[model samples]
Target: MDNKIVVITGGSSGIGRALCNCFIDAGYKVAIASRSVEILEKVKSDLRSEGHEILTVKTDVRVDNDCKNLVDKVIEKYGKIDVFINNAGITWYESNEDGINIKKHKEIMDTNHFGTVQCTKYALPHLLKSKGSLVGVCSIAGEVGLPNRSAYSASKFAMNGFLNSLRVQYLNKGLQVLITYVGYTSTNIRKIVKDDSKSSHFPPGYGDAVKEKGMMTPAEAATHIFNGVKKRKRSVRSSAVGQLTVWLNKLFPRLNDKLAAKYYS
Candidate 1:
């Protein structure tokens, strides 16, 4: 991985942060972007001490300009981009009872769906220049609708559709596009759960403990992602459980629906 230029968004925390550490250890020059400059800076500082080239950029994926700036900065500094990972995302706890909280739903769409679109669009040219790979960390949620997370599921579903179309278009260019179906990962996203009471339409349950039981650690998830990128795989599903979820959803949609309803309840 030495001398390879890799850009990861939402790199300040969770799976993204773990990827930063792994790639750096493999001798790659890595640039991490996120809305949190403080954490990014700390990550950069820590990696630099080990003689790894690291760049941290504060970015809000909701902004097109920020995405452009991220890619531009990477190119200006490294001369070429070998891989682009669109990992920035947000998730909310909703039960579908009163319908999704309009504000939170919009926020999820803006950050997870639209934000990914913006970053992918901006990075396309740079990636094309090097015939680089593009990766999106979608979820098993993308494969099937969950009971409580209407908007979050919809956004991920949309990401899958959009990236699939993009992959076909880029295939002829000798560029690879990979999207992953990640089950659970020990990420700060669960710890930061938003209270739906503030937004009455939203569901009430917080997912902190639930996620702890179902997901792998961020480091474990990062390892799957690293191997996927290194192999230039068309798609990477993080674990057997995640892949099984997709298959079960496809074969027994109603069964899973009932099970999910009970699980959420």
Candidate 2:
């Protein structure tokens, strides 16, 4: 994978960060894109100090022009984009009870679904040139409508449909579109979850470490993603829960809904 150019959004932390590390260790040129310049710079500095050359581009995937710029900048440096990972997404643990937060839902949808579409659209031409891979870091929430995650689920479901359609459209053309269904993992995402009023706050009963319990580590999930990329899997589940959720959603849709409510309601 030496010289392989991999671009990851939301690469400052969590699964994206792990993916960055994996690609760096594999001797691939990496570009981490995100809106947070401070965090992105910190991650880049930390990695570079360890002798891994990386590029941290300040990008907001939600912006159409920014998406185009992301592709343009990568191509400027690498001449081609070997892999583009659509990992930049946001969601809040608000109300799946009283109602959905319109403000929060729009934000989630903009960043997760439409954002992925825009980036993929901008990168498709380059990907076609390289016959490379397009990865969508969707969540199990997108696969099955779990309680407390309506917006997250909607965005992910939209992403699945969009990318799946593209996968079929480009199949004979040698492009690989991979979507990952991820279960809960230890990440800073929870720290940024918003309340019903749209203010970011930790949810009730939430603990820093407990939010990570019984969940796959981001590094572990990143390994699965990397392997899925290497194997050219069309779709991958990062955890057993994600796999089982798919099965249950198919065979027992009502049961899945009820069980999800029982656990998360």
Candidate 3:
């Protein structure tokens, strides 16, 4: 869709960055929003050098005003939004053995779940006007909880439910709501902790274990997202494992729980 505008949250790095490139290559006008102004400018400059023009907005999705301003800026720039991808999210890898870190849980929920809700609330009007798509870059954890990711899973589960409900609510309104279940990918999301003074609570050698297991690249995940949007697909899974996990959980939830525990452990 040449010149069709797509607004993405958390578009500075990782899958978000790759999504910018993918959409640009496909001839869409991409607008990205993130909390980091420096990273936003860098990504904008880098893309500008490649002859692709994009709009960047400094947005903290947890803030209602910021989310509203993000949509306002994109509409001001492009006249309309053809798609809005709620991709901004954070996770905590702490275990329940230490008791839930209520503070960290709130932070993750604010970023991942409430962030999606706020953005969607602001973007829905424009999306409805354009008969556009609303996409959530959710996770397999949303479908099946994993060990040591209680907060993250809860956030995604909330996101999944919210988006799914919107999908049905607007089914007769020519709106497309897509929920993408992303599997383990080679992204820095896991290693990042909300408090820079502390380190992630992942078990020792977790990085090495991830490396040994292998994961999808951000580009691969972006490609899947782009294709899903292009096709107006209701849902997509970034990895076959994620797809299987959703199905297995549907049929044999208890067995899937054991499998999830073993995989994460």
Query: Which ranking of candidates, highest lDDT first?
Result: 3, 2, 1
Each model's number of backbone clashes? 0, 0, 0
TM-score, per-candidate, Cα-based? 0.90, 0.93, 0.93
Tens-digit per-residue lDDT, 1-265, candidate 1: 3488889999988999898988877778889999877888888777778777688889999999998899889889998888899999988766445565889888999999998899999888888988988989998888878767787798999999999999898778978898988877767776666533433222234356445665688888899888998898988898776676677778998887786565543
Residues 1-265, candidate 3: write the lDDT tens digits.
3479999999998899999999888888999999999999999999989898999999999999999999999888889999999999887777455667889889999999999999999999999999999999999889888887888999999999999999999999999999999987766676565334243355323463236246888899999999999999999898987788789999999999888777665
Over 4 Å off, model 2: 96-98, 194-205, 209-211
The candidate, 1 or 3, that scores higher on TM-score is: 3
- Please, what are the lDDT tens digits per residue for candidate 2 over residues 83-174? 99999988776553447688878998999998999999889999999899999999888878866777878999999999999999998999
Lowest summed lDDT across 10 adjacent residues in model 3 is found at 203-212
The global Cα lDDT (0 to 1) of model 1 is 0.82
Backbone clashes in model 3 = 0
Evaluated at residue 119, the lDDT of candidate 3 is 97
**Residue 15 lDDT in model 3?**
90
**Candidate 2 lDDT trough over 10 residues, lowest sum:** 194-203
lDDT of 3: 0.87
* Residue pairs in candidate 2 whose N, alpha carbon or C atoms collide under 3 angstroms: none
